[model samples]
Target: MGEQHGCQTCHGDTDAHVADPTMKNVLVYQAKGGSAVDELSAKCLACHDSDTHMAMWKMSKHSRNDISCFNCHTMHATRGAVDQPTKCFTCHRDIKVAVNKQSHHPIIENKIKCSDCHNTHGTATQHMIKDDTVNQLCYQCHAEKRGPFVWEHSPVEENCLICHSPHGSRHAKLLVEKVPNVCQDCHDWSRHPGTPYDANAGFTGSSPSNRFFARSCLNCHGAIHGSANFENHGLRQ
Candidate 1:
């Protein structure tokens, strides 16, 4: 029906992605599935591969396991970076348990994702790091703890993982264990706050000892480092 009246069907505007500078290299559509693994490799190598830091993934455990970009990332889903954890949980069921443990990062309630802490794409450092060290990675959120304080807690600086679980924990404040005992592990009576102890006042099955050993160190040092305000009796306010 050449030049037919009321004919509405028509071709769209000319494709400009290839010709437009701003549109150059913009992803239009992504392939799917293992059948397209070669295509996926080629597509990824266009930006990644030997020339980039991400080339390490060519021989990584994930690569050996056949974990690819599309396996964890969706090109155009309602779930983006903010929901990446849920996407990861689709395969890693243990992550669900980890994120739900008693003391977890605010990921679930805040809708933050695993990618927020762990960089999956690429980085200049190992582990596809967004930061140089584990503490630095944690400091991205716990900036208050990254202090050059007058009194530095060794464990606090050495490895937070020792006392905290990055995924989660069963104890309050993300503690690795119940207190008094947990503190006693390193702070025995001999090293009472890091000093020699007197046998005369040695820790025995006394009333005072029971009082002191009944609860976690946090029961009294609730504020811990945050406890700067002390009462007249030298107790945390």
Candidate 2:
């Protein structure tokens, strides 16, 4: 309540509030506070300067879309951090459903937060990803996939999304689709028999083939991500 105190950090110019207890004289960030989005954000930006994680906030998707800081944060709220997946999922309903899928990144388990890979404050990337590229972000955890292999998978090097879904997947290992099928997306595999093709296929192979006999494509091609081994050009290492 004092000038030297930190109350003024957010409740800007509390003199009027002190004078009139009933007056909505102080700056409030909520809708009933009658403060504009820009005005409310300006108050936060005044302290959260654009130097740290808040850098490039003006270029952020949330900023461009008129999202306010209070939308995700309530510093004086009831209990512990309410801005976890609970707050994020409120707006991102689709991702909420995705995270509950068979294969996910342990978000529901509370092992990770959305901020682990995303910068809600601001970012230069499309999805507000913490890193410059999707592959770079995935490399944070899947470091083995980040290799300077002699036989580099073009899709793996280009984007991890091509074969995997970051949020979740019905397929194991967060794969976008079942094996051999995911491979057939580019390999154009029609030579061998017993192909239990994807949804579009008319003939679903009944007999077990080399591709689906054991662990599917992983049976022979384990290092499908990339291969440093000159011994196996097919990346079977």
lDDT of each: 0.59, 0.79
Instruction: Identify the leading candidate in terms of TM-score.
Output: 2
- The alpha-carbon lDDT assigned to residue 64 of candidate 2 equals 84
Lowest summed-lDDT stretch of 10 residues in model 2? 206-215
lDDT of 2 by residue, 1-237 (tens): 223537777887788788888877577877667777878888887766757536777788888888888877785777556748999998899999999999999999999999999998888787989999999999999998998888887899899999999999999999998887788777664543444535554434432455344235665578888888756645464
Clashing pairs in 2: none
Query: In model 2, which runs have C-alpha deviations exceeding 4 angstroms?
Result: 1-9, 12-26, 189-215, 230-237
Please, what are the lDDT tens digits per residue for candidate 1 over residues 11-84?
Answer: 11225533674643333234432234434554555444454436565665456566666676654456556466
List residue ranges in candidate 1 displaced over 4 A.
1-39, 47-56, 59-61, 75-82, 122-129, 189-216, 219-237
